[model samples]
Target: MPHPPKELYTIADASERWGVTTDIIEDYLRSGKLQASVHLPRKMMHKYTRQPTECSFSDEVDVFDVDSCDPYSYMPQQGVFNLCYEDVNWDEAGKATLEKGGLYLSRPDDEEKCYYGFDEDFVLSRDKVYVSISELTRFEGEYGTTPRTEQQDCPEKVVKVSQDANPELHPKEKESLLKIVIAIAIGFYEFDPAKKKSPIANKITNLVYDLGLSIDVDTVRKWLKEAAEIVPRKKHKITPELLSDFGIPPHAKDD
Candidate 1:
């Protein structure tokens, strides 16, 4: 339950904060859009070799518990190790280096013997990179470069139509309605008669009426059954004419 370093965020943390994929964060680091630091455990030092016996340097060190998921030893005391780095490209081989804009202090030339540590069991880690929060001002406290999906785009049109039809609906209810309307437009719904005040419940009452559609579960079942009959026979692309057979007006679809 130790707190993560206040100044740094792991790739997963940055991904969530920026509303982007981990790969995007890594890309930002490579392009120099953000600065980063690598957390090198004492065990991961001396590449492909077993854990070392003692600290290489004489500085005061910080103790981080070994991640349970990591294959290294589970003993928390054994996980204690020092961190170090140098500025280098991620792809740099033969010598340990950062991916793009930071230093990797895990290993150094054997002759130089620049490793530093404290007296403790060697706790090596996966060599995860942490990004400084200060370097993230571009999209701080907001969603960043996550591209919108077609599903999101589709709901926007539905939301506009619903808002025009019912101006009094709360914004949150309208957002919920968009989801319900899209589900119905695509011919899918989990009709629950018992749940009365669900997101789609009252909001959809007016919408169903506005659309001149029946909300009865049995009626919807009949429509789905009929639609199923037509779908298999066509066995091809669904066009406006085919949609009309399912009671959808041709103009309802976006061009």
Candidate 2:
């Protein structure tokens, strides 16, 4: 058997050698089908070296002969869905089981399932895949064992706001303020203290001052109360009176 070539080529070299355009190489990179490393220029080599050396190098150089999988290429005719595998239906579970080593999609069935797969391959339902980080954390709390990272712990400052000794706002306002505090604590956004010229802004400024946050209370309050709504609480434990009110007959509780 003849020995394979040991010399590695830059993307430019490979492009010239293969008679392909640089765009093709870039496509391969974006698709994650190819791996490349960058090469830096050395002053000594640029000034002192006499013999013609390969000058053009890529910030990203491709590494050949490694096993690479393109999620798009093997993706079923579905979309990319992020979900816990355990939640999928039996048929989908079977398909995922088959593609356990690599990315794969579940087979479609009558039951509801989240559609997800790389590129065209999908799990086969209009189910939403991506979720906000906060939701993922909540899921972790409910499931006990989360497949993803939990929401980061709140800072002491926010904790203090939640435990305000003298809350100078309504329940809804306080709730909004708490959310804003959390947003600020998580470094998502900041309140501008100088922009508190409106009545709503003034209210927020008062709340911020009360909470000991040196932020423009008005701005913070505006963001906190903006689009705020009360979420309806869920009823899990039903009383006998509630059941009777629903017309389920008194004997049904015993059964």
Candidate 3:
């Protein structure tokens, strides 16, 4: 089915764009770290089918009873559910709506496919409640990526420092940091790009924040190569691993 042209994204798109794993995204949803919305059935909106007039289904539901408590919106899709492992909208209009404190809902496309635009006018009523993780999202807060102009009284404080201006790291310090980066990047075990997407670059970026140092992923990778210059060399490392998740090549060969 065709989707609406509204400002909405799916879980996969959200993960790739936000630089976060779907697992982390799901965790945020489960914990309510991310605000989300679910899709309502069209049957609820129609008064004719409000009653359990059907005799086929084992479990018959009074449409009015369901609508009384949680009146899901039937805008996006008819009977199809609206959900995502992780999703978000960073468009200007989306931000504007959020700034004014309005939430957007993805409407069902004319073609019947998911991934359409958000409905700004439709707001959940006082009694509408989400029962499950219909769709995990980073629609608000940190993951929401609110712009500085729209930030709170005290906006996020951070001093930008370019790693290019910094002096080269000593071998030991570089190696230690590299080890930490690799450990975190590989999620322990061994470093392989083929099996999974290595977040090495992102990990290094995070470490720089933690250590208050100016370090780039290239610098860290260079340090790794420098550290690898040993008598017997370290041990097994990369071999046709899939670092493509990080936008690298599959079976990434040694540089």
Candidate 4:
């Protein structure tokens, strides 16, 4: 039942508040890390379909015309193949009458007054969240709802998210990283501050400082502790799709 806000925010709104360019916010938005208030069109009057069972329809009487029992309805000699529950046979009514393949698929029920339409294909991603805030501006949400079969683009991004969620790490690499992270906390590759420091830990620490990435030891411990307690990850087969999520296209998925 969640609906888009009455007012939406724009890229400029986010940019001005953070004092950063829209490009930065754009990345966050695409990654789903930031909740962007984009204008998601709702073709409403709305309604997917389920194969029908039972004839408990409320008062449409006159029922099936005596000579017109649908064969598909399975009543000895009832409804024809593809005869819709409400006695509609798109084949007979013709596609143009129903506006077949229209952006929104609409249909009528018992009362005929309570008409309905399918939501815009891309509208499934809306889940409006609200926090105590001031102004609201417009957002440009997605409008593409083509099915995966119809879509001639990348497949679903099923690559597993990582503990660190590094955009740089190939998706499969997270399995290795998870092991290492947990290993550090559990003392398997012990980062002993008392005894000799782990060469691996030192190298990584040096790498962080060398890259000018500043973080506290407490934060490192916190992440390691969390990683250690996580449900152990199973070995993942590396694939081109996994590679693509990490921002490196290997062309393996081209086939």
TM-score of each: 0.26, 0.16, 0.23, 0.19
Name the TM-score of candidate 1: 0.26
Q: How does candidate 3 score on lDDT?
A: 0.41
Per-residue C-alpha lDDT of model 2 across residues 1-255, encoded as one tens digit per residue: 998643444445444443557566445434534433222222111001112234465334432221224233232232222333333343533332212222322222315332222322233231222223333234336645323112233356577777796566897787766544433322222222233243444555666678987676646555544422221123113444433434445455454
Worst 10 residues of 3 by lDDT: 95-104
lDDT of 3 by residue, 1-255 (tens): 997433444444445445667556546555656544454544223111134456566365433222233344332244333333233323433322221112223333334222323333333331222322223222434345542343442333321234445757897886676554443344333444333344555566677889877777777665544433421222235423423323345433333
Ranking by TM-score: 1, 3, 4, 2
Ten consecutive residues with minimal summed lDDT in candidate 4?
Answer: 74-83
Instruction: Please tell me which model should have the higher TM-score, number 2 or number 3.
Output: 3
Question: Which scores higher on TM-score, 3 or 4?
Answer: 3
lDDT tens digits, residues 199-236, model 4?
A: 54445566678899966655665555445444233212
Clashing pairs in 4: 8-137, 9-137, 69-78, 70-78, 70-79, 70-80, 71-78, 71-79, 71-80, 72-79
Residue 241's lDDT in candidate 4: 44
Runs of candidate 2 with Cα error greater than 4 angstroms are: 1-76, 81-104, 107-138, 144-153, 158-163, 166-255
Of 2 and 4, the candidate ahead on TM-score is 4
Error of 3 at 90 (Å): 28
